[model samples]
Target: MCSFKLRPSKLSRYFCENLKIMQFKNTAEFAKKLDAQDKLASYKDEFIFPVINEKEVIYFTGNSLGLQPKRSQKYVNEIMNDWGGLAVEGHFKAEKPWWDYHERLAAPLAKVVGAKPEEVTVMNTLTVNLHLLMVSFYRPSAKRFKIICEEKAFPSDQYMLASQVRFHGFNPEEAIVEVKKRDGENHWHLEDILKTIEEVGDELALVLIGGVNYYNGQVFDIRTITEAGQKQGAFVGWDLAHAAGNIKLQLHNWGVDFAAWCSYKYMNSGPGNASGIFVNEKYLDRKDIPRFEGWWGTKKETRFLMEPEFEPMPNAEAWQISNAPVLSMAPYLASLSLFDEVNMDLLIEKSKLLTAYLEFVLHEIDVELGETTIFEIITPKDRGCQLSVFLHGQGKALFDYLMKNGVITDWREPNVIRLAPTPFYNSFEEMYRFGQILKQGILEN
Candidate 1:
């Protein structure tokens, strides 16, 4: 029963049309049949899953932290071996010289984020990078000092925005404007966001929102929103923490001023892995722009001279405040290599089908339970790999039961569970199995 107007993208239209006509059966055989036909089926063997009670758990928390790729060990060992043998010399002598190691990720990561190679660079962690990017994009004046964001944003973002406003001697209450969802609604409307931007008009300094809402899995219209913000003479940036590798992005084409995303979630790097950033090509090599400078952000040709003047790199790397964390970046490079092999388009196609199948399975389980639907899929049609479900007439005991039964999911406050079936490793058979387990948990409790 999930239905919404498809976005203008051809992939979205194709996905929506196929989803409407696709029939699903609540059987293991049917699940296996679908998996057998999946073009990305073999990619599942590339990841490592945890086992509990002698069975591999059905992992559905990729939105929180993706499973590790097997190749991550090899990548990590390369760095370790070089450091053990060559020490300081390893900076220049390693197979992938440590000094320029992060440069290898730019091209592939660019493809995933739909940016030019020079516009993207791997850098510090998520919130840290956001703070750094804000140093440049959030320049506020007395007339245009207000920032706009979504209501109920991630806690880290709330803290970051508040601190930024306070640092500039502005009160958070007066400087920050949050666009709220409709009464009793889980998702945001595109028109409401656009209207807010219009109303904010001349006073808006910046518009920064999570491209994909972490809590509800809603995918906002980035291109439209970015244009609206810019029209009002405000800079636009995105926190792509959940959207980076989960959906198709065109930061460059979208004319986004800046963006930052962690690789730990959909990118499948490691826990708190290095973050990647995108700065529009227009901002590159601009000496007039404001940013915090560091040695690593300098041009490589003159970096060895240790000059007194801060000569920034002619690309997004200028935002980097410190030398690359080689250890943390190793796993990220490994994950990006896998991304290069599969490409975002193929993964997205599979994701559409896989997520639709999961939705169908949830509906089947609800039908089996009773006339009153106990499960409400709060996530709207404009979503990526995640579905946030509100469990009506359910409690934490049901979540605990599922966890004990080997279905790993993320539980939110009140009564909600976030399920993300990543295209890389999640299978249709697992989706079918999860539905069975979910039914058992509810009935037993």
Candidate 2:
């Protein structure tokens, strides 16, 4: 197994070249051929690809960061030209004005999340928005001061919750309840989650959960969980960084109090791009919620008035603490335009087939090999494009081998590889090819 170097073996090269030609010949020729007939195949050409060794390497890391759209360069260039030509006046004189630039993005993002125009705001990064939303919604009373979250939440969120508790003079270990999956289970049972809520009813103040878990790729039942929390009189919010563009969401109709997500993943925005937040319409009229405010959060019409008093704009905009970053949002606009070409329904349909195809191929290889190859998928079947696979202890070695061979999936710490075939740009062929390479890696090792 250690004999397998980082260099692509002769076997790998032969496999890649033959697979390329065999990619579109027949349905029986694995799923790669199916990509040739895919209705959304044209979408792949819309994005820019980085050339490594003069080849467009297979990219399965979209769940972490999506490939840049070809249009993004043009979009950012336009912003650059505007800023250079108009200087400070670019606030209004430019084509996509700096002042209302963020608003232009809100419509497309709202369309993606199934929210009303006023309910969504493109603002801070995921964890920051989560903290900001908590400032307004996580109002704990003397008796109800506990917060609920997943046992294995993203670390930044854990830190955010800990700090939020300390800010209120409470110990996180005592006041925050982490809902855990049973031993040997990949996901938390809905009944058990509800039971936890029931047991902590009066003490729970907020229930914050990841829409799609970062580690296992489990798409949690947001509506069900939020309903349970609301029944217990707890405020419900979601961290949608993994689910926003990867899965369909109805934050407003689901009756969630708030949600936040970054645009960089399946949304295809660039690295560290601006994120979005959602606030239900029911809170639109409630001005009493304690909030962190700035001039940007003030009413747009009188924003220039510069009054010392902060009168926040209605809905999600009121949550903004600063002006939108112009350059950072240009990529979001470029990515969102691609979404306009293909809506969630079509993309999701393709995604289901793609993921199911991957599962079928992996299982087929496992059966043929007649050995325990040490790869077990840990994500739930109901998950989106991402599939988290657990390797039997040799995780880092396998991950490095896959990267050297250009099968670019992301590895989480300890032992998990996350492979996401983004519906908008990824193809059936890519999934099939990855399975083939992965199978070869296992056998060779």
CA deviation > 4 Å runs, candidate 2: 1-33
Q: TM-scores across all candidates?
A: 0.96, 0.92
Clash pairs, model 1 backbone: none
For each candidate, what is the lDDT?
0.92, 0.81
Q: Per-residue lDDT for 1-445 in model 2, tens only?
A: 0011111111111112112222122134545457766889998999876665677778888888999999999989998999889999999899988988888878888888989989998987888888898998888778999999999799999999999999988989989999999998888777888888999989999999899998888888999999999999999999999998888888878998899999999998999989999999888755697888888888898998888888878767888888889899899999999888788877876776666556555655565566665667888766888888887746587788788787888988778888887777777777667767777887667
Residue pairs with backbone atoms closer than 3 Å in model 2 (clashes)? 23-33, 32-429
Q: All predictions: root-mean-square deviation over Cα?
A: 3.6, 6.8
Error of 1 at 328 (Å): 0.5
lDDT for model 1: 0.92
lDDT (10s digit) by residue, model 1, range 151-217: 9899999999999999998999999999999999999999999999999999999999999999999
Clash number for every model? 0, 2
